[model samples]
Target: MPFVKTTWRNSISFKVLLAYVAGVGLSILLIALGAFALITSRSDILLTTDVAERTHELAGKLLFDAAGRPTGFDDSEGDRVWTFKSLGEEIGYRVLDSQANVALASTDQAFWSPVAKAAPSEQGHFKFEREGIPMYAATAPVEHNGATWYLQFAVSERLMELLHQGFAWPFMGAGIVLFSLVLLFVFGACAYFTLGYALKPLREVSESAATISPRSLHSRLESKNVPWEVAPLVRSFNSALERLEQGYRVQQEFLATAAHELKTPLALIRAQIELMAPDKGRDSLLDDVAHMTRQVQQLLLLAETSEAHNYSFAVVDVGEVAQQAAAYLQRMADAACVGIVVAGPADTQTPWQADRSALFTLLKNLLENAIQHAPAGTQVRVEFTTSRLTVRDWGPGVGQAQLPQIFTRFWRGAHRRDHGAGLGLTICQEIARAHGWTLVAQREEPGLSFCLSRHHAGPG
Candidate 1:
């Protein structure tokens, strides 16, 4: 699987504001359409009703004169017309007296013919298109003289057009203004909705940061919840974190590789030094020089993997570690005819928390010390118990007086006074300290007993 850094995904938030605005706009549209339709319908109905009522009243007034005589209306007829002379102004009408006729003709002859066409004998008002012009007219029958007179009345198209022109555009303009004001409210509502989702991106950021862990270093915050305005910041932060993690990993790999590469050259240098001739009459001075050179090389190795060096720690079992070190020195032990034996349980659960190289070196140095001191054919018994590993060799045992100083750096003992460098136990002690353990030398009748204990595990 391609490695994905989980850190960014775990730490980043993604969000959208447009969805909320769309929803808000839709709701406003629905409500506005519903209200607009209902209000306009009611307005049209009321206006039409008022106009119809006025038309009927005008018909009543013209049919009865001031003398209460039905001047142009017939008591019995299918249609009638009534023209009233009011304030010296002409009003047009039609009549039916057993036949269609102009019972009343207003002074304005231009409007008379159209009004004269109204039929009083018509049971109800009739409307129809003529001359491509609309007309409004009403027909009624009423008695004008003692003899029956029928009358009809009509209105031309101009008044209706004037009504809409004079009223509707201005009303519609006002309505549009009202709608715009409402839209302002709607926009704010939509903005609030957008803001809610937009802010959710910030929440995602907080949640992602909360979940950040070493294993999730590569994952980025989701772009979905990140606001476009803030996305740059989140992306930049993720990029920076990625670079830092890469730098630390590179440093660690370089240190591990460098330490491994340097060991061979160091070992070759120690071997070359060991082949040098003695200064003579110095009492095992050649052996001491070779041993000290080896000790210096071992110290270099120890320092390379030290915390002072860039070392990573991991867990290791003491027994397995002792066996591995014994294996590394097996050839030297065989050449010396020093029998190296390791004895413990099949496995022990006790483990050391330490740098792997340091652990290996600690065990190897102890094993090498046993092999160095023991005589040919002598047995170096390595023992492992629940909490300690003990290496015993049948060599000249350390004197009790010098035991305390054995682990001090460069403390050469009286027994090997002219034969060995003094840093072996000191390096071992440093390794033990690094692992939070202890190293001690117990003087035995024939050899030294080196014991390391797991630290701080005593029970009350």
Candidate 2:
């Protein structure tokens, strides 16, 4: 039922096509009805004519002596003299005297009897329904030797019904089929272009909306070119974009000011903590300050990467960048009793065009994440190829359910022990996205691997 409802709501072409077919079908139905009425009406006339003609022939065959009356049946005469073409099933006819008494009946069934209905005038006819069977009859008065007698002829309802059905259905079937094809072609073509013309502005609006990213929020939708019905919607959307751009500008300013205001006080606190005693409590205070400082630095880096126009691309080697990031994080790895191993093609320069600072930060965040999570004495392996850099650590791998959330801001795993804020993977993801690359996280057998690679667009 949901599938049916969705198709019905979304399919304008099918609705239009069905409407066309229905209109044509109704016209054909009306035409068929009129034709049936005409044929049925004409069959009555034909029945009356046939019975009247048969009565006239029967009148000629009437024989009488000095007294005028119907002659007795002759055994030598064949059935032709009595048989009727107008009578179908249960065929029969009656010969009646002037007093309306049945003198002779052609079949074994009881003969038709006159009722209170008006009798047929000379050469005229009347219809009667007896026992639910329509009987058509015509009367012709015959005079023999100065006395009078009458001949009556009749047929049943089944005859006329058969004739009508035979003539009506074939033509109706043919007419419906031909009109269906014609409507499908003519109306289908018209509806296709008509819908396209009507939806043209909506398609343009969609294309324009797709291009308006965070950097392009200043762009507004053009309402003058759209239909009047959709102009209000476009205006409302442009107004919303205006609000968003304003909020984005304010938020960026606040982040920049906060970074400046918070960093100085944090640096003073770290300095003050270092001048204190070498006890566990003092060490804990210093660690807390360092953790806070790292969070602020990551927040600042995230803010910078949000603005894409600030980037400057340079040609750099993936292997060289990986080696430098490992060296920079070596002391941190050693402090945790973990090893750092950088592996790639020997003497192979896998060159790529990227913002060198962004790539370095991307590598730094991933390396830090791998080293922090790695078990003691287990190496964090950094591998580089022409297109991608992968960092694998031999620690408890992320759960399958949590892999998708790893790159989200401030999302930390249950197995993690660091007091570090969870912006590391988020920063790496932002950098990768800024450079049109893809960052992926995979859960290994006994560890997790984070990889960054060049993203390729699909074929047009």
Candidate 3:
């Protein structure tokens, strides 16, 4: 299937397994061929060498008289006599003098005489036929009592057939096949386990990378125990993180600097507007200046909250913080003709560890956002516990599609009543992130609810 092929192409483990299997198969095939060739070449050589050795051995066993004329063999109780008896008619030999005359021959002399005559003069192997049966022969020189003689030994072709077709070929083939299978299995298992062990560090690197964000860009992958082949990639990735961290820090610094620079001029403009005579244009100018000043201050707070190191952490009560935020936004709720209610666990003792100032800012922003959206005479409820906080307003909640964009920087929903900059929810989300928490928006049947909960283990 196409899926299988794609996996084979893309997966490292599949590729490695395939390569290992192929390499092992090729090696096994080559070894089997080489071994077969060696056996084939050695079989012929062994036959000839065996014939020559038997010729010499028979010559040594020949018995002679005092005049040095050849007689019958000693026929002693030894290996040569036993070999002659065991082979019976399959083996034949002849001993000839310096004049090339036969001195002694096996009982079957008629068949062996032609073979001896056809043998080479010097020591070597030759072939002949006896009654249409093919045979192999070898001639060798012999010395006895300072007289030189030649011995020719012949064996039937059936002997070679027995060695090749009868036993060696079949056993060698089965052994090669069995050995190749066992080797493939054992080596394949070893390769699979080794590849898994080697790739463990990569999995660890992935987990570490998942934890990295603008806030925790300082983290890097650990290199210890990693394979040498992958070490360079890990180093390169760490170097990339270093560069990214530097760029993010520079951007945060620019945002903070720009917001700080705008604050002083806005203050001076406000002081100047206050000096002007009471008029409709003067009030409009002051309102515009105040909105700009609020936007600048929110930008500064966003920059600070985005960095993990900016917040000082300590134990703080969630319920108390909720009450404080409600009280702080009471005037704004009153101006909008909306009631503010705080409800949570009765315990006042601090139970959560967080940056007190950042937590206050986060609560304040959520409550302020709720107050701005709630309908007249409707209540904006603030609820909290040791682990969570929620702010709900009885007003026209945003559509489902707009829920995800509520915490995005400078993003305002369709439900709005003022010309204020949309950085409040974004600042709240950043503060929650710095404290290893999650802030989310859900649509209550008749309102929108914002929940900030201690959910994650660490900053992004």
Candidate 4:
């Protein structure tokens, strides 16, 4: 129960729904209260109206003599007579002349005399007590043969008691309660669906935010069709993304520029070292210069591959690229006493849409890294298909804890022995990302397998 309360408090949709229901309930309650107050305050007026109507109806049925003198009511209509008779001793009426003398009365006249005497002479509602029992009375004007008379009607409290005994008030109260419950349900459902629709743009913005990374810093949340209340937040988020994109662009430009600047000095240093006379240190200096040159070149390539527009994409044969990469690294593999084997489809005719040069670089880097890691006299396997490429090396693979950092920039696992900079896997990952693909490194039984494939939508 506390969990439910906490969730309801924390959830914006639930809070909105609760507030809406409360507002609707309050409005309905106010309306019911107002209606009850009106009915209660005007109850006497309603009873007086009832008495006046009954007096008029009885006046209409009066039978007079030829001299236009007051007489009794005509009972020719059996239904009307039966309705009046059903009231028993609860209803009584009296007709008075201009002299204020009783000209005629109902059969139960004695039961109403005290009430009539206590009533006011005015033609409206009046309250009185008769033998300790409360009574309601009304006086109305009567006209016959151009002479004016008055009629007084009285009803006993027993009539209202009969209505209560019949369960009239209970039925009415139950009906009101049922109506309020149904209205609350309907309003709650409407609030739920309306909130879901109204908040749809927020969900879209969240999804778009989740997909944004350093590689996709230029992407922005869509603002169209967003609610007015949330538009400012969306605009602010897009503005932040724009700033991040500018900063990332500047950082990449700096890296590329630094690499470009170092290339010439390194070339000069290599030339001078080669021009030196043969000595024990001369070859070592040249080797160090060569390694620095290679590191600079890899930095330039990393910066270039990080951007999407740097690659010129086209349809190329994947099998052909794999073979070329293998052949290019064959000398290095032989120097390390590691064999290179390329195996795939029978025809080796796999076609894919990618940048030919970038594709070659990606495959070359993977195979080079595999060759460097493979044990002496062991073969590094290269597999290619229409949708995926796999490079497997039978060497000491990194631990499971190090798998996530394999593709991280400058992250050389414990098993690697290469003197080169650790940008090979990071470059491969960048190239795969540029092509809308994923590069994953899996720990094999006795080695590591790097799989490059298109990003599939569902689980593997």
lDDT of each: 0.62, 0.76, 0.81, 0.81
Q: What's the ranking of the predictions by TM-score, best on top?
A: 4, 3, 2, 1
Tens digit per residue, CA lDDT, model 3, 166-201: 787789888888888887898789899888888888
- In order of appearance, the predictions have TM-scores of 0.36, 0.64, 0.80, 0.81
RMSD of each: 18.4, 12.2, 5.7, 5.5
lDDT of 4 by residue, 1-460 (tens): 1433455578779889878888878987887786577445646666666667776777677777888877777766345555446764676677877666777776465666565343234646777767777777777777788987777777776675456435655676677788788778876787788899998888888899989977789888999978988899999999999998999999999999999999999999999989999998999998899889889999999999998778787779989988999889888999999998898899658888889999899999989888878889998998887788899999998898888998998887665556778898899998988888888999998999999896444111
On the 0 to 100 scale, the lDDT of residue 412 in model 4 is 74
Query: Over 4 Å off in model 2, which ranges?
Result: 1-9, 34-180, 200-204, 207-227, 274-281, 415-417, 457-460
Q: How accurate is candidate 1 locally (lDDT)?
A: 0.62
Candidate 2 lDDT score at position 404: 84
Which is superior by lDDT, 1 or 3?
Answer: 3
CA lDDT for candidate 3: 0.81
Two-way TM-score contest, 3 vs 4, winner: 4
Candidate with better lDDT, 1 vs 2:
2
Residue 393 C-alpha lDDT in model 1? 86
